[model samples]
Target: MNDNSEIQDVELAVSRWLRIGVIISAAVIVIGLILLFIHGGSGYPDDYYPHSLSEIYSGTITLKPYAVITTGLILLILTPVLRVAISIWVFVREGDKLYVIITSIVLAILIISFILGKA
Candidate 1:
């Protein structure tokens, strides 16, 4: 295939994945909100919320509304990171060394920040 069509294919795949991530995140948040209403609270003390990934995961497993909402928020935050990762893969497949290097740097920074932010 020509470069133009190849580019379009990449864009389409990226767009589709982004859309899916957003829709899933929104749906999860909505479910959490609905649960909050039904439960009449966030299932946590007032002004308190999960502070770590583990906490969030445990709470979500327990069906805590606040934890569920936090998980949705995390998904939303990671969507762009996923896009960056996909770009790295695409660049590698296309044998674009320069872009692959740049995208790899970006992905590394994103991952580093994500991990450091947890500290």
Candidate 2:
């Protein structure tokens, strides 16, 4: 395949990957909602929900519905991060220095935002 074709293939793959990630995340959330409906999630108005990774993971490992929902939401949140990482890989492989640098910066900013968002 020519360079253009190869690039197209990569782009297509990236798009499909993102689509699949979103679909899977959505499905997970739907399942979690179903579980919540069946098992009944526990939370009073005064209680704050679990939003931290550790809390979510601990609950999820125990099959807690709300935590499962949080896991799905986290997966949805990670889709773009995965996309950016893939774009960086593609750019590097293509020797597109400008794009590689720009994508790298975007990735860095994304990481920083996640870190700061948690604080």
Per-residue C-alpha lDDT of model 2 across residues 1-119, encoded as one tens digit per residue = 59889989998999999999999999988978888898866421346678789988887787778888889999999998999999999999999999999999999999999999998
State TM-scores per candidate: 0.94, 0.91
RMSD of each: 1.2, 1.9
Against the correct fold, how does model 1 do in TM-score? 0.94
Cα error, candidate 1, residue 61 (Å)? 0.9
**Over 4 Å off in model 2, which ranges?**
43-48
Error of 1 at 69 (Å): 0.6
Each prediction's number of clashing residue pairs: 0, 0
- lDDT for model 2, on a 0 to 1 scale? 0.88
Give the Cα lDDT of each candidate: 0.93, 0.88
Model 2 TM-score relative to the real fold: 0.91
The stretch of ten residues in a row with the least summed lDDT in candidate 2 is 40-49
Q: How would you encode candidate 1's per-residue C-alpha lDDT over 1-119 as one tens digit per residue?
A: 69999999999999999999999999999999998999999998888888988989999998899999989999999999999999999999999999999999999998999889878
Candidate 2 backbone clash number: 0
